[model samples]
Target: MPKRRWLVAPPAPSTFSARFPQFPPLIAQIFYNRGITTPDDAQRFVGMEDVAANARIGDDPFKMNGMSQAVERIRRAIREGEAIGVYGDFDADGVCSTALLTEALKKLDAKALPYIPHRINEGYGLNSDALKDLKEKGACVVVTVDCGIRSLGEVEAGTALGLDMIVTDHHSVGNELPRAVAVINPKQNDDAYPFQEFAGVGIAFKLAQALSDAQQQSPLPNAQTLELDALLDLVALGTVADLVPLVGENRTLVRRGLARLNKTERPGLQAMMQQAAGKNRSMSAGTIGFFLGPRLNAAGRIEHARTAYKLLTTQYPGEAEQLAAQLEATNRERQKLTDEMTQKAREMVAALPPGEFILIAGSPDFPEGIIGLIASKMQEDAYRPAIAMTHKDGVMRGSARSIPEFNIVAALDECADLLVRHGGHAAAAGFTVDNTKYDALHARLRNIAERELSRLELVPTISIDAEASLSDMNWKLLEHLDQLAPYGYGNREPIFLSRNIMVKSARLVGTEHIALVVSDGVVVWDAIAFRQKEALPKLAPLPKQVDLVYTLASKVWQNEPRLQLEVKDIRVADL
Candidate 1:
């Protein structure tokens, strides 16, 4: 742990409610801080629906990039009764995107099968052999979801075989886009879609929307009517897991999507819920990201992601239950692997120069599939740029985690001359490089970090909310905070900084927890700091007062409800 720095947050702004008349002062202040200002915006923020309107269906279909040709090509295949296959990636986003389109096609009475490549065995995105195999299955058209943006060679192979492909993905496009019939990714250089922050599932949903609109407008006899809304559950799961900013259309989709998830009653979800007993029926973002998403993701991490996809979209209750349980068990196994690998990676990085800005470690058995989780854990432990790698077949594959100050993908781009492939956002990314170049890559990366990072970058700081009095620690205050529900990666719970207070009593409770009863004349607050038992000797005997920055939360002990404060940082009072 590092030494604490004491600083007080400014008082709450007065424009909290005046600017947004719909919210209570506290809720309004929270909304204002979170950047939701107008009444219309606040309403949409809470309810998730601003305007009830369908997606825009482009006219002069040929004017849209590749879509017109792809759709017409697919319709011809259906008329000729040619088999069609859907290929997907192996992550939550990929699974949902694949399932969304498959369901939409099924609803429209089209015969389409799904195929997801294994993460460990097949790696990411589309591949040459996989496309050829699909083409051999009597398929004339192939649709790809959440992948294929970087698969130029694979697309060309299918095109040469007279196979048309429609690519729906959200990854950044390479210099050369795939020659697929229609590429629906918003990141494409020629794409004009207004929203660019969609997750892979969101892109797939947009295609479904467009397909439905096209069907509705067609004058052909017995034309199928498309239904796209049925896939929102998958969209919400994928979008939130992929960590896209939940604002605008994304926000509306997730807000309503979570509601649908709670009452989902889908055979697959119900079976998963039974496997994960004791969970609340009213699922929140935490439930999806922490509980469900991980279990679904575990199949990809340790084995193949197809099991998770099948579990989500399966109709057989028995098969769903068995698959969901298998996924739950796999997640537990994944936790053990990640924890061990993370610990080893940390020790390896710690042996390097303590001031090194970038923490890079690798091994032959680091488990290629879970390097991302290991990198994230290492980053949390060291608060630095982290990369965890695994070497196989003369190639090194890895995942990188970075802070807000550093653009990891850009850093990789700077080193692209050495990398075989790399792509992702600023905070996180994935890459592969030749094993022979590993040493030079390490040296170059460290050099870049040394020049870029400063001393302040080593230590992490907690952001505190407005200063409060000990009197403010009460049921009412805690209840008021509940309005900020559905907390997760983007929207976090509030952290309050309380002024001068005395430690009424302090003791070591659990093996490594410091329990404190702090008091001001107006109120008393119970506080706890995990893994801080050593602080008890100094804090318990303190006669002087203290100032603390903390977060207010509810603690239930033996079914008894009580207010508790989580101390973020603390300092002895100057007075």
Candidate 2:
């Protein structure tokens, strides 16, 4: 294991309040410290736009390189009464897209069947075998979501069979695109779409919006106009789960989608939320991403992904309950496997050469489904690009996770000759390599990380928003700070660093948590540090002065509400 490093952030601006007069002084200071400078930027995000106006199509039809052509193909399919198929990816993005498009096509009187490829067997993106099967199932047009940006052979198979295909995806494109009627990916250089960072479901939702407008214009004979609002719940689920930037159109979708989710009568989501014990509160993106997304993904990870697709599209309450129970059980199993794999991965890294920039470890027991999670854990623990591999089908398949400073995909591209196939974003990626060449690949990856990551850049740093006095932790300040809701990936909650606070009292609470009483000479507040019982000796004499970085949160238990400090880092304050 490598030695740890700490990078302290520079001090916050002293003139933050004067610089931003629109926001309250405390709020302005917090925002400025977090690098949010402009009033318009804060208003657009923190205000949570009243309506997702960007979702609406213009008086002039929405134009892109292939949007019109894709819409025409689907319109022709509806007019001809031909069967259409939607081949989707396995993740939340894929499931939501499949559901959204299926419902939209049904309103247009088109028989649109959904097909999600199995992660374990079918792998990601399109496969020629699946296309041939869907083609034989009486489908005339095939639309792919969340995937198919690199499926040239599969598209060729569909085209050779006289089945027109339309691709609505957001993954990066390779050198050659599939021979589809239209490709609606924002990442394409020729694409004129306003926003290119949309998740797969985002692109699908925009297409649904455009199609709904097209239907209103022509009013398909004997067809009902589709309402797109009902699908926002799925859009929100996929967008947050995929960790796409929650700004611009993505923010609007998630904000409006969360409101819809609170009232969502979707049987599948309701059943899962109920089983997870989160049905009582209003659904937030945090609940979806942390509590619900993992359970839904567990099905696809360990067992068959079809279980999740079935759960998402299920109409019967009984069926949804049964699938939700299955998903819950699978999630428990997944947790156990991941825990075991992570421990083994840590031990393997321990045996490596003392100081390596990258951690590349492989084991046959590392479940392919959970290796991605294990890789992510290593990256956080070591603050470097980490890769975890498992020998599957005589080949070494691995998942790579990188920090913001390093581009994992581009790093892997440098060693493309050793890999069979690889494609993903800058931070996270996946690839397959020969088992015999694993050693060579690891050496090459370590060399790449050495060149890219400097010693100072490899540390996991805590970013503090601003220094504050204990008296500033008031209800109004906490409430105002919460306007920055739905924080993840890009937008993060503010963390404040304060010094020389007295520890008035301390005790052990529950089994592993520590409860504390602290004062800033103005007021005393109650705080709890979960799983910090081991740090009890650090405050043995009840120090009069202490320093810590924390976020303010309100905790409710047994209907009793109180403010609490969620500690991020702690150290002795210099008096």
Candidate 3:
């Protein structure tokens, strides 16, 4: 890994002492350092809500643009005993929403069948062929989750074939919206939803909650009732997997959802956690992002997503075990493929000019399913927006991942004349083009990126909370940090810096880890640098003093825990 520029925020103002006396001085400063300003803000930031009870009232679903109509249409289908199809994408968020809504409908006696598109065969959104197949299979009403927002042509074709469509998606809207029974998306240009940053599955959950509430007056009122909290495990999984900010309702949902995840009754989740996360480990955003989400997404990436949806919906224990094991192996294969592709992509970009604002790489043999992962890896290495494509059947399908300074979807919008279809968020998006247009598209995208991106943003930065003395690291400090539980995107884990610290001793541990005993002269601490064995040369010449960027971490063995510094970056003093 390249050395990162440590960008530490200035210390909080002195008024913090008089303002938040209830909190310890350091705790108050930490909150300020994280952008907290008012006392109420601090209270909300540090306080934990009863996520399970949802004691903090959530937004009403009826307020959403098409939520009421969507609920009414689905309820009528359920009451009339119609065969309904739940169409969804192939990612973790889409799979979870498909299962959650399907299960909710099944309890109402409606034949709710989940139809997840194959990542490779169907690509994304509502395809005309798939719609015809669903209609042929006796589906009268089709509700889409996490997809179908920009499918204007598909929606028109489906309506021509006698299908009533309801779209519940959270992706950014384009010039046209689908002409479905109800088009519900929070990011619409004129949308008035209180919170606009919900994950795709979050929109589905709102629909499920509204349907559950509407069912109170249905003839099947005595049917299995829906518990919104019960589905939070899926919510936590998708929200974290999608990497949406964990603030506002997303935060509340994930915080409570993680609790549900830990004790999830879903046999698939239970078995998946056992295999992916190991037994008895606490659930966190990291757990979902690193373990659970990948296995769930693997079924979609390299295989049909049904493998995961079936795992979530199946009630049989033996089936769940087999599916979870399959996903585990698939995930391992996915990792191997990603590593190989990333290396090949790196080699491709090694010859690019350093000032280029974007990276574009493609090959006919590259699996379209893993293009997003490749784009992300390219962005990480190049520190610029990236596009990775797969050439097949005379077309180039590409996935774009961008830096914060560049809006890739908008860039695609500028070059729309050369593209077949394109839609996504500011940070990431996808598109298709005739193989002949790939070169023109790449050139246009690079020009747009260079014109828009600032040089400062082309460099990766590590934001440190504050400089800390080793003496200040203690159980009391750790206790204060507990209030910031359930951290993820936006609400990230705190990072601290300790400068000019003497290394009493250092040793290379295991295969690629460095363990050290360090001191600030007055106090001593133990530190570990994982996957950073190359730093040994920099820390040589014995008893060296260095500047360290780190996070306070805990290491436990045999039921006893000790504080340890997780060294993120190391710089020799005055280097």
Best by lDDT: 3
For each candidate, what TM-score against the reference?
A: 0.87, 0.92, 0.96
Q: For each candidate, what is the lDDT?
A: 0.76, 0.80, 0.86
Q: Candidate 2 at residue 25, lDDT?
A: 71
Give per-residue CA lDDT, model 2, range 1-575, as digits (tens). 33333334555465655766766676886666566777776676577445553455222226556888888889998998899999998777788788888888898899997898887787778878888889899999999988888778778888998889898788777777788999888788877667777888888888888788789778888688687888888888888988888766787788878888877788988898899856576677778888888987787789877788888888999999999999999999999999899999999988988777888889889888888999998887777788998887778889989888898988988888898777778988888888877778888988888888755446666767767888888888888877877777666777777788888888998988878888888898887777667667788787557886778988778888789897766666776
Which of the two, 1 or 2, has more TM-score?
2
Cα deviation at 354, candidate 2, in Å, is: 1.8
RMSD of 2: 2.8
Lowest lDDT block of 10, candidate 1: 50-59
At residue 41, give the lDDT of candidate 1. Answer: 70
Off by over 4 Å in 2: 1-22, 33-41, 52-63, 454-456, 505-514, 530-537, 541-544
- Model 3 — TM-score against the truth? 0.96
Clashing pairs in 1: none
Per-residue lDDT of 101 in model 1: 81
Q: In model 1, which runs have C-alpha deviations exceeding 4 angstroms?
A: 1-17, 47-73, 219-226, 277-281, 454-458, 470-486, 501-575
lDDT of 1 by residue, 1-575 (tens): 55644534454477556876544455666666677767777665565233233333223323336666666766666666777788998989889888888887666666687889988778887777787888887777899988887778778888888788878778777778888778877777776666677888887777676666567766333446564445667877888888887665676667657766776757898888667644544566766777788888899999999899988899899899899989988999999999898889878987887577889989887998899999998887777888999999999998999987677887887888898777777888888899999898888888787777864545666666566676656776666565455555566767777767888887778688878888887777789876776666766466548888778877678768778898776777778
